[model samples]
Target: MSETAVPLPAPVFDPARVRSAVEERLTTFLDAKAQLAAAQGFPAEVTDVLQDLILGDGKRIRPVLCVAGWRAAGGCGDEGPVLRVAASLEMFHAFALVHDDVMDRSATRRGRPSAHEAIAARHVGRPDAARLGMDAAVLLGDLALAWSDELFHAARLGPDQLAAATAVLDGMRTELMYGQYLDLLATGRPSADVDAALRIARFKSAKYTVERPLQLGAVLAGADVGVRTALSAFGLPLGEAFQLRDDLLGAFGDPSETGKPAAEDLREGKHTALLARALRRATGTERDLLTGYSQGVPPGPAEVVRIRAVLEGTGARAEVEVMIEERRRQALRVLEEAGLPPAAGAILRAAASTLIGPAR
Candidate 1:
């Protein structure tokens, strides 16, 4: 039988405290790895760069949600194992981001050079610098993935908890990889299939980012199927809304705030819903510009203005805003009906607001 502890009365938890614990766990784990690498004469630069990326100014959203899921599912007693699991999730996230950036050829991450770019920059003069960076960054991403497993193992879960958590983690990783595959297949070959774009978002962001993390925590707490079901109901639509907002911000948000190159998504010809809507409504030169995969439009002021006009002029932006709102409402309605612990519901409510910016 699963070893779920009884829920504390009302089970109030501070998000700040959870975030701090997860951060500390990641920091200390990485620190030990760094020292071991130094003593063993492994390349110190690997851990050095990873430290900056993992311990940087990330929002710690996944880890916090994991803890919230734990509390919501009546996890009690030692919080240590759950925190370590949360940190492992973050490390896995770092792996995903590194590979995603490589796939996107994204030069920047969080307003700094991305992993490949940074590695390439460090060895500026080599003839194979670009290829070398790409290769080395893939290795770095793999290392992060490896460490994620190591940290997860070090959590020292009991037999039942370990089995359950492993199932959740395995499913999450498999779904994420296949989602990335779908995304890669669809990218740069956009069509007016809103459903197609949404499918990508569902797998790529919704299930991978929100649903699985919440489930992982719940499973760690030995939650029953019913509680896990409630979490999925609450998490899926909210996660999709989160990605929809991300698509908008990618095309239209302030680069400083978003921490990426302006219009990076459009520049890559990503098959986002916003782009699909625009294509469905566009005509003549507007359509031509939207389909200009081979035109080599330079990422400059005029190009930015023109693409902005396209996304805005077609009403796609407004349409997607409606989509986001609709999904957010759906998720909230699920929350109200899920009969979750009050504290978990509150954390999720706040999370929804923050992800989509407090509903205008």
Candidate 2:
């Protein structure tokens, strides 16, 4: 087995181009909405926050997937409605992030203070900074959730297609919530069984991240069940590989590149595959070092380096890299078998390769 044997499709469509197109469309929609809100005498602060959240830095992968899926499923329509649906996904994602940061007590998002903390920082002298910030962010998140539903309702799909797409969205939300609970449970407990941890990662990270977004697009485009199933076969493994790579970066990636503290996962005592493997394979003092260095308010940088050394020494890093390669290969196999539109599949294949293939 080669370390990475996944054959990617040619780049039929550039992801950066697709991302730019989607961002422009979303900005237009948001600008129109902001103007309408201003005409209604909405608070400027509210409108500003809404606009910033919508136009903030993001990869815009979900909506792009929605549009791509629509194209792949033989849908012939203006891209506008599909873009709205995709933008709606972005709003829902904002809701998730706001709440997630609050739960994780994270200080930053996309290289800025998190929504709650940002607002809190503005009123540092106020006695209720934390409360005010949390309240504002909660309402903001709620607004985004409501907007997502409204946008979905306004999409161009027929009644049956609309119902099917909405159902998928609901399922995605439910599964993500459950995955979060599983994550909370796994922390500060006995380390999850390796296989079980992977299962949780798939449901929590992979499905919501990739499979659901693609399914939404396919569903809205009225794809048959066979097509939808085949896309899942491709999306699930690719999504899992994506998260696995994220786990590696969380521990070992340069902070300048990744925009988060390195070894933050270790500080959080995250039971990722890397950590689980280290726990299982380390011997004597290395195992003791890992166990001892796993938790605290802020793990020291030297300890993080030590943890990395332990992971490398135990072959866990190599194992994880190999697993990522295998998952990518499996995803490509599914894509080849799915008989999707060659051009669309080619684009998706390239996106997946860029997402999960070895770093350049």
Q: Tell me the tens digit of each residue's lDDT in model 1 across 1-360.
A: 899898557546777888889989999999999999999999877887788888888878788888878877888889999999999999999999899999988888988888898888778899999898899999999999999999899899999999999998998898889889989998778888999999989888888788888888999999999899999998899889999999999889899999987778766778899889999999779877776742334467677778789889999999999999999999899888988877778878887886678886
Candidate 2: deviation at residue 73, Å? 1.8
Clashes of each: 0, 0
Top-lDDT structure, candidate number: 1
Q: Cα lDDT of model 2 overall?
A: 0.77
CA lDDT, every model vs. true structure: 0.86, 0.77
Give the per-residue lDDT of model 2 (tens digit) for 212-275. 9988888878899998898788888888888889989988888767766777666666668777
In model 2, the clashing pairs are: none
TM-score (all chains, Cα) for each model:
0.94, 0.88
Off by over 4 Å in 2: 1-12, 32-47, 190-192, 283-296, 358-360
